[model samples]
Target: MGSVLVIGSFNVDHVWTSDRLPRPGETLSGRYSSGPGGKGFNQAVAARRAGAATRFVCALGGDGGGDLARALAADDGIDLRELRSEAPTGTAGIYLDEAGGNSIVIGAGANADLSAAFVTAQAGAFAEAAVVLTQLESPAAAVLEGLRRARAAGAVALLNPAPANAAVAADLLAATDILTPNETEFTGLLARSTGTRVADDAIAATPDDRLHDWCRALLPHGIVVITLGGAGCFVSHADDARRGEEAACYRLPAAPARVVDTTGAGDAFNGALAAGLTQAPAAPFAQHVRLATHYAALSTERAGAAAAMPSAAQLRERFGELFSAG
Candidate 1:
């Protein structure tokens, strides 16, 4: 299979599970655990377990967290290209409620140290990639450089603008081929890029045509995927580039899943989507989206972030025979 290259961060995550989220200045007792996470690492693990040949590129500190990252990558058979950093490893504190919702705070240490020069040095790896998936957790210059190289290599350049607060420039997004944003991130992008404000909660209820217009405005030359969590997902493609789909815009219902934790659902979607693209390049775009939604749903059935990603076999087992075709 062709490779999926993921360029981003690696954060060791500390988690707390409670019956409900804590209010301001509120402290509640909850179960505690720590593990390997970070959007980039979570997605990389997801892709690898989804049966793709994957590579993860990031910066790591000379610490136990970094060692954990390296060990995990090796265990998963992911080709890891990590730069050593003087800064400490990144970390995240995640608070998960009983309802499967979560709030996260990140300490971007070595993650912030990933440089454009490091990304540029991965030209050979980029050349072998079929899909290059990246997020905004790392430095913008490094992320932008990865996207630019992906375009130059003729690989599918997929961008996930997460955190809903990252400062993304127009030129950085100009190089993207597929832009995936959850509802909140979509709202933020729309407001920042087009000066249009559509409340995130109202996105699913908005007219399909209107959402398509907003998506076009966000990425005029590319495709836009707005993941609406339990409400399902929406897809909008540029008229000129439908990527083998019959419709320019459409929606897919959420796949069934028993809820546990949702910390890595978005990462699962992006990673599985990348895997599907490489594994089934000739399939209709909708088919890939189906695989991603199902994969993501299955991920929610488990707990933790990177540890929560389900494998291809598990996905097929949960969703039935449909996934066998993937």
Candidate 2:
């Protein structure tokens, strides 16, 4: 397996489960728990579980959360050599209703302190990696710096623009190999609608007559992989005949499973996609997307973000049957 490096935030998530989301100023009683989370940490866990040799480069505060972050990374066998302790670690407060929907608020504490210099200093690790994944949890400047170094090191750059921030540099995105986003994030990027429809059972809007225009808007940069939670994902590749011929599009239906939490589904999918690409670079893009979907489906079966992430053995045990049967 190729080495994968994850650069982003390490947040301790405080989760509360309630019967229903509270209305404004409404209070409700619910279950409560805390766990390791953050897009970077979740993706790193997912990649490590998918059998990728993964490393995590992030910042935590010199507090209990930082200690827990290190412990969790150690337990997952992620290389924490690049992880730093400076400010207080970041934290997230999340509320999940009975329908499995969530509302999250992040206190970017030390995560906001992640700097370009820190990322540039860790460029050597990217040199040894086949893939470097980052998200918007950290500063945009830091993310761009990481991408610059990853590209210079000849590593494939994967960016997950989460939390919907407009401060992202377009040049950095142009250097990315794969750009993964959910419905809201994708719509945020395009800035204009192609009059696309949210496909039945699809969590994201699919390209219709407006998709071509949307692709035309983004094609000059990098490949776009829009993840449709439950419904699957749609991929547009640069060299795809569909992009040139008919608008290259690939969709992977979500694997059948009971969903307990949707929180980190996108992270799981991105991690699985990165790991799959590393393991099977020659596999068709559609196949890679399918593997990601399988890993994501498995993730939703359990609750919590990183806690619910499956290990390599468990993932293979549950889904290996499908692979073999096929």
In the range 1-326, model 1's lDDT, one tens digit per residue, is 57999999999999999999999999999999999999999999999999899999999999999999999999999999999999999999999999999999999999999999999999889999999999999999999999999999989999999877898899878989999999999999999999999788999999999999999999998899999999899999998879898899999999988999999899999999999998888888998999999999999998999999988898887787666545
- lDDT values, one for every candidate: 0.94, 0.78
- The TM-scores, one per candidate, come to 0.99, 0.90
For model 2, the local distance difference test gives 0.78
RMSD of 2: 3.3
List runs of model 1 lying over 4 Å from the truth.
Answer: none
Q: Which ten residues in a row have the lowest lDDT in candidate 1?
A: 317-326
- What TM-score does structure 1 among the candidates reach? 0.99
Cα error, candidate 2, residue 242 (Å): 9.4
